[model samples]
Target: MRLLELTLPDAVENVALDEALLRQVEETDGQPVLRLWELESYAVIVGRANRIERNVNVEACRRDGVPIVRRFSGGGTVLLGPGALVFSLFLRVEKDRHLANIDAATAIVLDRVLTPLKGLVASLERKGTSDLASEGVKVSGNSQRWLRSTFLHHGTLLYDFDVSLIERYLSDPEREPDYRQGREHADFVRNLPISRDELRKSLTEAWDARLDPPELPFDLVRDLVRDRYRNDEWTFRM
Candidate 1:
């Protein structure tokens, strides 16, 4: 497994970049990779087939100057921006009848994330399909896509993000039905006690523990981020 530590200094075209990089990794040696990134500002990302109007408050986002975008994968729409740490793992695997299923893919991704988070916080448990919770609150959420021989698992870690802004820009209060309308941003969302550098270092160490030393994963993934993901068509396409 090769680990790719790619960071977006400012949120360029994250969704597009993710899709492009996933495609490239699948074409190459297709070693498993771990990618970490942060957005430039807050934006809403919906599934490819989702009805933007039905799932999100587009006018509210536009009025608030929030970008509403679509991603290559499917999941409920999510509010993303600063204070969120995004991680993606792209791997090549033979589709086994058992674990190749989406639920198992999520389990693998969550396990990889929780292995380092243990002892730091209470042990993480699955909130739903891809969410990991501490106590009754949600901390991390993930989603995946299995294509050809590769799978892309991506998700967010709320580490000190602006909860109030997320509440304001998301428009659809119904989006978080699990939490109910009474949920307060500060109460429902949280930041990790650790700093960005600390989290990144710890994540890399964790991946190293389980896989072969990450080789060309870094450069290959970074190149794709710069050239392909930064494009406009990839960001706003319906």
Candidate 2:
């Protein structure tokens, strides 16, 4: 697999690049890719179909000058800031047949990727469809999007994140796993007691990925940002 460890200066671009990589690979039938990135500032990423008014505190984010954007995948909304590590994996469904089914793919992929993290966070286990939890609180969350032959599995690893920010921006998710038990964000989520480097190492080791910077699809990423991610119509359409 190829490795890309970069954070685009713009949050929209970072989100766009995740889809760009998946598209680029599907177009070329290329190898799998592992991308690691972190945002230095706070941002709100809603699922493709999520309604901001229902899921996020739009006025609070606007007053604070934070960008509220939508990603190309379907999952719960998440608050991202400095201390969060984002890892995206692009895989060919033809090569990995496990990815052909959404539920099984999420479980198989997460279990494989999170094996090395057992040492980093004791008692870490997957709680719902795509959450990695420790003890009794949430630590990591994941979501997905797939194309004709390739799929994108990306998620966040909260190492030193401020869990309080979640409640400040996002409301309680409308679609909750039974395990959540109606607990609010602050009480339900917690950061992993680990460093970004440690998390990155564990993921890289799990994927057996090499740090090879392949030819990036910069034009596609820019186009996607301008056409989708940065467009307010696309963000609030739902």
Candidate 3:
């Protein structure tokens, strides 16, 4: 797999790039990739099909001047900021049965990615569909988007994020994973007590990720940002 460690200017471009990479691979038969990135500031990212008003605290977000955007995958809303580590896997769908089913794909991906951290934390287990938890507190949340022959699995790892900001910007989700147990944001999430470098190293080693930079389709990303991600009509269509 190819490795691309690039961070864009803001949430719109960051979210648009994920989909652009997926399209690039699907259209050009490009190699699979693993991307790692971090945001420069705070933002709220909702699931692709989520109802923003129902899932986010709009008043709080507007008051704080944090942009509310949507991603190209199905998952719960999340807060992203400086200390959050974001990883995206773009893989081709092959004969592997595990890569075809949502449940199986999530399990396989999380199991492989969390293996290196197993001994570092007290208990690292796959919780719900795509969440990784340590001692019952969620440390990571993941979601995916599938094309005809490829898919994009992207998620966030909270290394040193401000947990309180979640409650400030996002409301109680209309839906949640079973393991969440109806707990509030503050009680439900916790940061992994690990450095980004260590986590990135382990993931790269696990997938034999190469250090090659991706020739990203910047034009597509910009078009997506202008027409979809940054447009309120598309973002809040619900």
Q: Quote each prediction's TM-score.
A: 0.78, 0.98, 0.97
List of clashing residue pairs for candidate 1:
11-40, 160-191
* lDDT, candidate 2, at 89: 93
Give the per-residue lDDT of model 2 (tens digit) for 23-112.
999999888999999999999999998888889999899999889989999898999989999999998898877676889899988998
After TM-score superposition, what is the CA distance of residue 138 in candidate 2 from its true location, in Å? 0.8
Which ranges of candidate 2 are over 4 A from the true structure?
none
Query: What is the lDDT for 65 in model 1?
Result: 77
lDDT of 3 by residue, 29-113 (tens): 8899999999989999999878988999999888989999988899989999988999999988884656877787888889889
Ranking by lDDT: 3, 2, 1
List the candidate numbers ranked by TM-score, top first: 2, 3, 1
Candidate 3 segments exceeding 4 Å error: 95-97
Better of 2 and 3 by TM-score: 2
